[model samples]
Target chain A: MKKINIKFWFVGLILVSFLSCSDNETETLFPDAPANRAAQRNAELLDLLLSQPNGFKGVYFTKNDEFGGFTYYLRFNADGTVDMTSDFDTETAVESSSYEVRLGTTTELVFTTRNHIQKVSDPSYQPLIGTGFKGTSVFQYFTNDNGTITLRDIRNRDSGTLVLTPANFSNFETESVASVETSLANRDAFINSTAVTAFPFLSVEAGGNLTEFALNYDGVRLFANPTKFNDDGSIADEEFGIAFTEDGLIISPALDVDGVLINEFTFDGSSGFEYVATKEGVTAKIGYGNAPVTPLDAYAFGVRATAGVFNMDERFKSSTAFNNFYDAFAEFLLNTYSVVVGNVVFWDLNNGGQPYIEFITNAGRFWWDLDFEVTNGIVVFTPTGNTNASAGVTAIFQPLLDAFIGAPSGYYLLNTGTYLNFSNRTYSMINVDDPTMTINYWDFSY
Target chain B: MKKYTYIVFAFMILAFAMACDDGSDAVGESQIDTTPPILNDLDVWLRGNFVSPYNIEILYKWDINDTDIDRFLHPPFESSVRPVAEALQKAWIEPYTQVGGENFIKKIAPRQFTLVGSFNFNPNSPTITLGLAEAGTKITLFNIDFLDFTNINDIKRPLKTVHHEYGHILNQNIPFDVTYGEINPADYTAQWFNRSDAEARELGYITAYGSSQAGEDFVEMVSEMLTNSKEDFDAIVESISDEESKGIIRQKEAMVVDYYKTNFGIDLYELQALTEAATQELVN
Candidate 1:
């Protein structure tokens, strides 16, 4: 009986201790509840977004490698609506739309209605069919400093990073369109004019490293890629989205090279069209040169491998030596076979790693294969093979084909001075034997 | 004494365990948002035009939760919202009210309207979704950005959708005669897009999509009749060559008119005329 009573007392004491332990309070890191904390954070962000009296200069980056960035002037009102204008082609008209700051995985700033900002994300936008810029309107708040806020898009980590900084409202009101016009003019002066015979390249001197970059303008944005071509022959380039200010240009998200940054560039048109980026203690200059700033060997190979044809135009047949030969061939075909030639195309790298020049006619297409090589910044064609041509075609067209092939020195390929990119670019092929025999053909790939 | 000791231990343990809870924790405020949404000028206008009078809510804003997230959909442009909303009022709401009675639309109408800027393109199919209705409570309009008020065709597309979806809403309240589906039961197929609109009409249906199912066929008749002027409708009936198919179509048309009169207390012809006039007013 004494043992039983002792056992009961032991169990009773154990139960009492367990109940007391259950009542013990556990300490929490946050003084407030998680829900309350989230609500508070959302409210703070909403207040901060609405607090900008002068409005915000919003920079939105596209996730895709081909496209880079866009700029917008946004004014957030207390009514959960935002008035927005963008730097996209004569779109200075302000559009008002709704927005909301809500707490999800993180606090988010969502553009609830379609506005100028949504144009970049619109899937039906023609340039980026099925994928419109690959951008997002829902941005998660990342950081907030003095007057600037950084947000990451919620769709994908690399979808975009929207950075908002305070802007002078009055200045944006009057000078927005002026700045766009100036940017267009400056772009034309730099690389897109007929008189621009030289290729304009950028030299960035930062952190004791001087890197020469090839410049590519996609009409809407500008990109500077390092001249180093990869083993696969693709140019690994970094795109910088820039917005033109009244004085110069502002590069959004900044260009960082080896831990050194360059953000703004002032236009210098005294000597030639040059943009000097001296901001962030870095000196970068855009200078012009007759020869390409990048290596020539890989570019020529890539162009031939991808696009095998340089279609000839009337200008190529305008020379006396070429004109007589071309006309005689056409007249012969007309008189003999009643066939009319539509186009004469030179395929530097046709099927089987051979070269062929094709004559597309109303009757049928004819090809005469040739031996070719790319050396000394030019492509030389030797009239050796006529495997693709019929016996009758070879007998009648071989002599004309040989004359059209020009001298053994071949043709010197020069940029037409409008664009340097492979797509939508024009290159003038001047005969090595006769300099007067020059013809320009557009890529038309775009 | 031993039994008394056991009982006392049990009582003591029960007392200790019972004392553990004091019920001091109070219920917190609900995390659900209850505050009224902030209204801008457009929102205010929508409230006055749609909500105050008819109890309908127009959601022009892009809320991913309100749509199918898988489909790449966007909100209608702010500039396009009012034009589309006004057209809906004139063509759909006003005409229905005038014919169906003053309080007709208020009692029997979609409560919510969701406006989307981009067309809802299906990933695997060539067909694009123009509009969708959910349980007769909500109607989602797509491709609002392409609405050209100056073009009568553009005005007809959305108005036809409203009338089509509204037809379903009426049927939900009071269904069409079940015998109506029996008129041409053999023609319905999921692959209705394979047939042309002309072929579907020859098979006693109004449109290619109308031949998909009986419910769609009924709504198609309502939508096509209301959107098409009487002259166009008569011309279509006249064009059909098959006597049996034409008779079936005529039988369905009488049922549609009778459905409206008996169920909703509205003359289908009068409502059709009003809607046509309202649509013409937009282009003029």
Candidate 2:
């Protein structure tokens, strides 16, 4: 068996002086001072006592007297509590202890439970010492927004003078408390200053035909439309904008059609003005909110009410948001429908009713006709017509038919008959069966 | 008259002695034979006095040759004989039982078999040096080194080898489900061995050495999962290369998950997480 040896060293020195007289002669030097003078001296004494080190808080490192080399750090809280932890096997042995600070000519720190006391030899100045320091052998005084003091043995060569200095506490405090408020104020300023003079709308800007057009702001674009306007003075578009209202911008298409207020738009300093889109009859609400204006913050919003034709391309940059939307839509399609796509697929809005999807597979092309209607927070999808080869309609295309309805308030349909077309190693959107859709397409090769 | 009487008595005594020595009479009928050595004390000491924490039963057989007594008893002195056996039992049997169980020991029953001086080989499985009977008895010509067991941390080779061979024995007794093969397709090969150690580690397997064969690979996975610390396993995974290693790592991970779910009814990910957390605390 091998024995492990450890060395320990005593730290700090205390010096005391005594007054002595040679002879036992009876001599009294002002045995009783005047009452006024005594009162004055007591006041001075109280001021001096208050100035001495009273309590300590920060980090404390303890070395075993028997097994000298191993050191453990105890984190101390401002309320005079210490966290005692073991070096070996942390699962079963970590514990905490409490202490009290006693102030006097010589500062003393008393461990409440064990009655162990140690005098404070070092006084390090800090800016925000929430509580005063008390005498303790190892005292780490940590200020609220200032710094920290590290206590160590001054005598040992390996462990010399306990260093007391301010840590980078300012950085920690700023991040923990002040940063949130700062971000909110910045966001409010940005929204108030940058106003949308011309809202995005479905127009013939590309080729004199109604298609999805994004209103680019500060190089960031939002998918929206100015398709129709309200008879009232307030402008009604993909988003609503009242000249003077609590909500920065309001966009509700349901107000005219359903005669119900399904969405309410509001903005705060923290999250810039947002439109909360909910169902008329139901309690469910889903919409987008802007992020606080900070260099590090990433903005995101949740889609609460997903119905009919909800376009994800309206959320953020096309490259990132569009791909994510497609992925999500693919997953939703797999979960909802049993139809398979093999060859040519076409979206026909020729009759000017609700648009329908026609696809050609090995079993030949089948048309799944749909009727779009918006009610409350939901975009209800209804099927129309009957076409089958057997005794009756073989399969009802309710799921596919439901996918063409209008989305919630924050979102808008890119185009009435916009089809995500994939054919012959090319991906494109055929809008309104127009040939210009092929010209204004996103080419992956580009 | 007295001389004649004496002659007649002598003659009568000689005739009686001659008559008593009949052809059927036996010579020295009170012959004694030495009693065979009573093994009562030895049995009591082995069974009652010496307790195996692993709960293994002890059986003793006298060697006609007397050559194996010193090797089997180990350390030689009569007082230390039981202690040496106890030490060997703790060093080897205890770890096995703790990791496996009493059922494992039972699976390896009586725990002893005779050793032959002559060399023998299995024709079908030429690589197998030792043979175990269906009754849980093993026969080997050579003795295992107890002192060299200190290299238990060498997870790449020796320690892993012992654990793997033992795994085969256990697997043989209680056959694993065939579903284990579905995790990593049958196309998997030791060609992973051709890869550098760095490349293999990235894939999450313990060592490139494991990619040698499917059988060895399976055993390696079991041994590493059961014995090695999480830090050691993680270090190996972190050291692997980016490109060629992911497939191997994915395969190994799937295999380990399957093994735990199929055999022990424990979540492999949860255990791995716990082991990793414990190891991190130690290092930090």
Candidate 3:
């Protein structure tokens, strides 16, 4: 299926080209072979090529003995120029370049293009890589039985076969219907539209620094999310309209900033897309994508808090006042949510080891429930507490411990085994209760 | 009416002759490939940057029939090409032009460079070829696919090839002294690959392949002297155990140094230092 698709891609919108279409040997093409006409042999062949019907498509087929199969499309203009498009074959058919046609035993036309490399299948072809460096394909065209033109590509002993005939794609009319204001009301129908595609957006700054963004299109709209560095470029909120021109689908209208057009979403349904943005003579190419990417997930915050302490500030000047504040805060936290404090969330009951790890983030997984010493590390529970008491609330906080034993964070013995990559990350926020006492809280990504 | 009847009769016969005559059915002259050569940005880079200045054309497109088609090969990615080009301009071309004077390389340099991405593995032997200098006009370089312009060693591989091939080209332009090769004539062999670099060094040869032929040895000495640090060459000479073999290598080095001064009005040591600095700029 992939092979067939690639071939269809190469033999793009075929147009038939032929020298003569005759079923018999005794055929006269020039209705009136005028006596005044000179022997304009090559000119006559050119006339035959140019006089084809308006929608006549010409296709060149080459079965390269070394480099597999390939095709090129040639459509001649009345003004002596040939427009060509190609599927990359043994030789690339230079687009919008003039091709040569001449009269001999068979007609000869040479196709030329840059940005092409000849790939071959024969083992013998490997040794001469640096020797032959011709960037053109010289083909000799012959009229075969039944009027089909067979062209033999005589470049580099490649012996590639080129067949030219009248060609048409049955669905050209349907494919040409690029845009209709369908104004899709829902996601499913819009996403399933044949035109919708994920285009990898390449953004070039005003000075020429390039970055990539995956512009994913659902049925109704195309979206570019906030990247790790820049949050303002969320295309869902920013993109204003979709207008599909003959060139392609322009999802966002061109926006001008400081006299330079910057954020405009436009893509032709090809392997790549380019549009002028931010710079007049410079257009950035956003690569076309066939695969949808996984969206970045936002981190969820749990009702967790950690209170920072100082030795003796003026606000917490009295020991009795500090005790009262601590009791109230600890009670509020424990009742409301799962809170583990003092850096270490869990200490193994048997080994008493703290789980400290660098952010490789792929910590091991577990589902076993075991005793964990969770803490708020507050000395609030002491009766009129001694000023120099060793500690209070050092034992397991059963409620917090029970809530997360089988969960991801509780299961991983940090610094052991493989690690899990993150789902999301959140910034750490600190809430000040008073000047001296602040609660710093954060949620984990993994 | 009698004169008009004769004119009409003559026109009819001519029309009939034109319509019926189909001998040979030849239409026009022999076909000439009339299409103009295609020039992309890479071609422009080679022309405006290198060829326009130095009269050289760099062929990076993988021409398979021109390549060793028996081996699996690919061209350097389009993005990967410019770095090597820029590096060549910096390390080899610019430095030579700087040292030998601007018009020096412009007057005598290889006109074409064929870049092959994969190393041209010798099918007959274990040793891989870095490049080939064709009749002093063209140079073919292998291992372009793996050229990291940022890596000194990677840059050195091709830089070395260019200098080595340039040596051959220079020799072809004004042949090198034959007496330089006579110093180590008995050590030369076709089995240059059989020995290791270290073994060849012990045998008073700079590289294993340098021992293959005298012409190669002289150029190898030229390329090695220009690419490697002076200390590195001195270290190699110092490592060799045999006194007579060492003396022969010293003689050959002196001859190469003298050939540069006498023929090209260049100091080989100065060119080596310039190339070394250019290579360091890439990494640093």
Measured by DockQ, the strongest candidate is 1
DockQ of each: 0.31, 0.01, 0.04
Best by TM-score: 1
Every model: iRMSD: 2.5, 42.2, 12.7
- Please give each candidate's TM-score: 0.69, 0.24, 0.42
Q: Write one digit per residue (lDDT tens) for candidate 3, span A1-446.
A: 95587457435412111112222477776754533122254455455556543212232222322222223345555544455433332233333433446443345654322222232221123334432212224556544434355666554323344555443434322221111112111112223322323223444454554444444332212333312234564443223233222233232333333366653334333542343333574454443333312232211222121111121222122223233444555575556543423231221222333231111112221112223322222111111221121223212232222222222222111011111243222221111112112212223322
Q: Candidate 2: which stretches are off by over 4 Å?
A: A1-446, B1-104, B107-110, B113-143, B146-162, B182-209, B242-247, B250-254, B257-284
Question: Which candidate gets the maximum lDDT versus the true structure?
Answer: 1
lDDT for each residue of candidate 3 in B67-172, tens digit (9 for 90 to 100): 5545444454455567778778887888778778989888898888877655565665666777888888888887676677667888888888888899999999
lDDT of 2 by residue, B44-100 (tens): 566553334334433223122222211211111123234334433443344444444
Q: Write the per-residue lDDT of candidate 2 for residues A1-446, one digit (tens) a residue.
A: 11121111111111111112123447856644344344434333323222223222122222211111111223334544434332111221324444433322222232332111111111111210110011223222112222333333322213222222222233422231232233223323322333211122222212232222232222111113333333453443333221112222223222332344533333433432223333444221112212111111111111211112223333222223233434564565456654343422323333344445454434456665555443322223344664332322233333232222212221221222232552212122211111111111111111
Single out the weakest 10-residue window by summed lDDT for candidate 2 chain A: A9-18
Return the TM-score for candidate 3, rounded to 2 decimals.
Answer: 0.42
Q: B-chain TM-score, every candidate? A: 0.88, 0.46, 0.84
**TM accuracy, model 2:** 0.24
Query: Residue A357 of candidate 2: its Cα lDDT?
Result: 44
